[model samples]
Target chain A: MSTNREIHLASRPQGWPTAENFRLVETEVPTPGAGQIVVRNRFMSVDPYMRGRMNDVKSYVPPFALDAPLDGGAIGEVVASEAEGFKPGDTVLHGLGWREYALLDARAARAVDPSLAPVSAYLSVLGMTGLTAYAGLLDVAEMKPGETVFVSGAAGAVGSMVGQIAKLRGAARVVGSAGSAAKVERLKALGFDAAFDYHDGPVYEQLKAAAPDGVDVYFDNVGSDHLEAAIGAMNLHGRAAICGMIAQYNSTEPPAAPRNLALVIGKRLTLRGFLVGDHGHLREQFVQEMAGWLRDDKISYDETVVEGIENAPQAFLGVLRGENLGKMLVRV
Target chain B: MSTNREIHLASRPQGWPTAENFRLVETEVPTPGAGQIVVRNRFMSVDPYMRGRMNDVKSYVPPFALDAPLDGGAIGEVVASEAEGFKPGDTVLHGLGWREYALLDARAARAVDPSLAPVSAYLSVLGMTGLTAYAGLLDVAEMKPGETVFVSGAAGAVGSMVGQIAKLRGAARVVGSAGSAAKVERLKALGFDAAFDYHDGPVYEQLKAAAPDGVDVYFDNVGSDHLEAAIGAMNLHGRAAICGMIAQYNSTEPPAAPRNLALVIGKRLTLRGFLVGDHGHLREQFVQEMAGWLRDDKISYDETVVEGIENAPQAFLGVLRGENLGKMLVRV
Candidate 1:
């Protein structure tokens, strides 16, 4: 039997998660069940939403169990298969991440064509991250052509795609906010009409400077001040899709910037929160459009890869701290 | 010549408004020009939205001019008409209140039948207030049958109607919060499944006790703590119609509650703000349905009438203080 290494939640964090909260455990690889496959993960995604699962509270998805491997999006090669179709060395995408080996039912894994794109792309732009940006911007916020759009966390995986999609859809102006100057420049390179670094000044002032005419659609990934700034700059009947709130995921105290929420009534704004799981209806359309964009060289994505499985916790914490320029992943 | 007594904005309020902010002026009632009519105002509405107009800041409606008559919903009889169809003794509804008489273009006034229902009914159950509740609860929130609904400011005009309509529409449970114990009791009588006085305890605690299963729709009339409470008690994919924020209308400081708005992301909640003006399309259908309810005695309405144009300011102030049981009107 081969030895497998997996990351486990040693304990829940008080506010910000630290390396001490996670443990790397060694286990013996088991034989595959009748309809299961054991995969050797190549690249595993570390996303913002995984932070929510670290808590014990009940939410849309159950909390990640303590002292158990935390599972997410992973791309791997099937090392052993008990299923009919899947064979050894076939590239597959599954929901069992944060480990060297994933033992899941064949139904839970989808075979991917590694020849068309890098196998790691299956965990980033061509998968749930890209789908989230596409669905949130078009279906959730209902962004109309020639309208102005504002997206926070503009350098992240979903945010970068949101900005690019808005431009490709004929948005008059797309404003983006990022944590660094380099990311702001990257946003501009991604075809954003205006981009700002939220660290320079107040988000409202920076956003106002970036988008003077006001924002018609806001794709919210970094909540708190970003949400407040978007609300302040929103045109009448503006819509916002609340995708993620990475800014306050580790905060112990409540945010104070959205104090002017009363303005929503006068502006007649709509703020809708959505999950990609409920948006399965848009997946087919999103995949087609996103794939076309990729083939035509109209879209580009960046990835920040960590070397070892033992660094998965650091990768996740780096995502929370806005250290990654785009999708952060752990390579096993 | 006849003298017209009208209320004028003396000065903008710093926080909470007072009688000093309004001045009663006597002016000669002018003769009607072509395509115009002079109306003898019978009853004028004093509403919460009027408070917003008193401020100097720009909003959906422009701020009231200093030392000028403040206008709102008024029911009156046409005393003189230069327009072809309108004749004397014809009752009309117009947007020129806080006055004993009004002279306006005929197109600005709608002819209303007084014999079918009391003319004051046009300002309450049969008018904009009723339509706000109808459109907000149904169209904006998209509330369905068997859903649990929670409404704040349940004793107020719009709030009262929202509770009744939800019950009539086959809601599984209806909860309401009011300012006074008597108002809470009235909500129960009005067919609310659970009613609580917001003063009794923290709104979240009270709401949780009222609807342990959680709320599907929230008609937010009070905002601030009430909005926070609704968000806390909301189930997955819950919707909130932000009709008013009376709780913070007079506050110089920002509201403290609803700090947990980040919860909207995890819970997949939708918070929408709307003005009654945009819902003109639903008016005819709403009036027909609301009128039928009234004729069948399926609905009841209450009003707190303050006599004389001089007391109109006081009546408007009373509305802000939650002093009225339902609609607060000034009989001129």
Candidate 2:
């Protein structure tokens, strides 16, 4: 047995989660049982979705159990194994995050080739984050070739990938909205045809100026004003894939829905909400396509790596505050 | 030429429309030009959608021209024909209402057999109203055989047909909400498994009591409280066909959107807004199936016919106020 440090949900958050809601504790790392492997986690992800999990309400994912280790996407090196095809030093991806080490069933962990790309990518562009952008754009929104695409939270993990994927797929115009002028410049550098800082003016005015002809598809991560603006700027038969509403996740009061939603009737718009867990069937296809794109230099990714498991809470809070320019992760 | 009395838009209404917004004027009915027929209208439909046309804003149909005769669904007998397919004494359906006579292009009119069903049925159950219910449920909502269906405006023409169609297509349960207690009982009489008066109590509590297992499809006609309530009681993968929002149509202020819209993510809900005009491809199939259902007594219909063209404006206002039980029509 060995000692490991892990973060636990000390209490459910009422509004914006605070560091007090999390507790870092040292515990014994159990030896591998039959069909189990022990892993020393190298990287763990902190995402906007985690804020929803901290609430005690039932959602697509269950709330983090009080005083228990909170789990999410993690990449690690296998230290010991008791199952067939067992090997030490094999890098694996699993759902055992916010921890220094994890004892996981072999079925829960999948081996990833470190030589294909950096192992940390397994927790980001090569993992659930990448798959979300792919499935959401191609399937949920049903993006078509040469159609215009608009994305909110363009500097974040899913939004950045959405804009790039849309571009690579032959989108005519790619427009993105971010919180700051710096993020807007970063989006332009990332190949977005048009980018705007939502802080510069009203989102509706900014979006109207960015997409004068209206957008065909809107990939929404930040809801509220962004969603309302998208609804106003959508073309006939436009589609909106509601991936995340990070803007309203921490609000104690129920956020008002878009007042212009009635415009959906006149425009024949479709707004659908989705979670990535329901789309595991697309993983193999996403991995194959994304690998080709990365090898051809058609896509790029960035990560803001916080140093330790103890800082996971702060990293997650940083994601909500728009402090991260791309995927936010903790280097455990 | 013959003298004809027609209804015209005198002025646009600011909030709820009043009789003063309409003008009844006498004009010369034009002689049939080449490929045109002069029809003496028998019945004119006063539908909720017409109220939208009273506004000058662009929509699926152009706004009713100010100080000119308003046009809508009408059934009439051809008095003079200069077209190949039409002749004198033939009953036809055309888009020229609020007038005693109309000069219509033969191609714009469809022959209706009064011997098979009431000629007015062409303007109600056998026409656009039926098509709206059919395509909205099967195509827009993508309803399955055993899912629960919830409809608002259940006592209205489209809503009544929607509930009946869902039941006939093997819905596990059919629930509806209307404005009056009598309308609730009428919905139950029309094969709706459960019905409620939205005015009796909070819509959420009533819908929850009516459908304990939750609704899988919501055919929304009355938006606002009903839509919000349906969202709350919807199951995973639920779909809402936004056919109309009678509740908010006349409101000067924008109605608040559903407060719990974030639930859309966890529930995987799809909300699509559609107009019946876009679903014309389903007309042949809808007419065939609905004709069979009507012939077999599997479906039924009702109408509140106002006596004359002079009462048409009042009948239209009645539709907005939820005063009509089913289809509201004006007889010439």
**Top candidate by DockQ:** 1
TM per prediction = 0.99, 0.98
Encode model 1's per-residue lDDT on B1-332: one tens digit a residue: 48988999999998999889999999999689999999999999999988888888888789999999999999999999999889999999999998888999999999999999999999999998999999999999999999999999999999999999998888999999999999998999999999999899999999999999999999999999899989988999999999999999999998887888888887889999999889999998999899889988888888999999999998988999999998999999
**How well is each residue in A1-332 modelled by candidate 2, as lDDT tens digits?**
47899999999888988999999999998689999998899999888988888887777778889989999999989999997775889999999988999898999999999999999898889999999999999989999999999999999999999999999999999999998889998999999999999889999999999999999999999899899999999999999999989889889987775888887888999999998888999999999999999999999998999998888989988999999988999999
Q: What is the lDDT of residue B268 in candidate 1?
A: 88
* Model 1 lDDT tens row, A59-131: 8889999989999999999999999999999999999998899999999999999998988888888999999
CA shift at B65, candidate 2, in angstroms?
2.4
Q: What pairs collide in candidate 1?
A: none
| lDDT by residue for model 2 (B82-183), tens | 999888999999999999999988999999888988988998899999999999999999999999999999999999999999999999999999999899
Error of 2 at A29 (Å): 2.3
Q: How does candidate 2 fare on TM-score?
A: 0.98
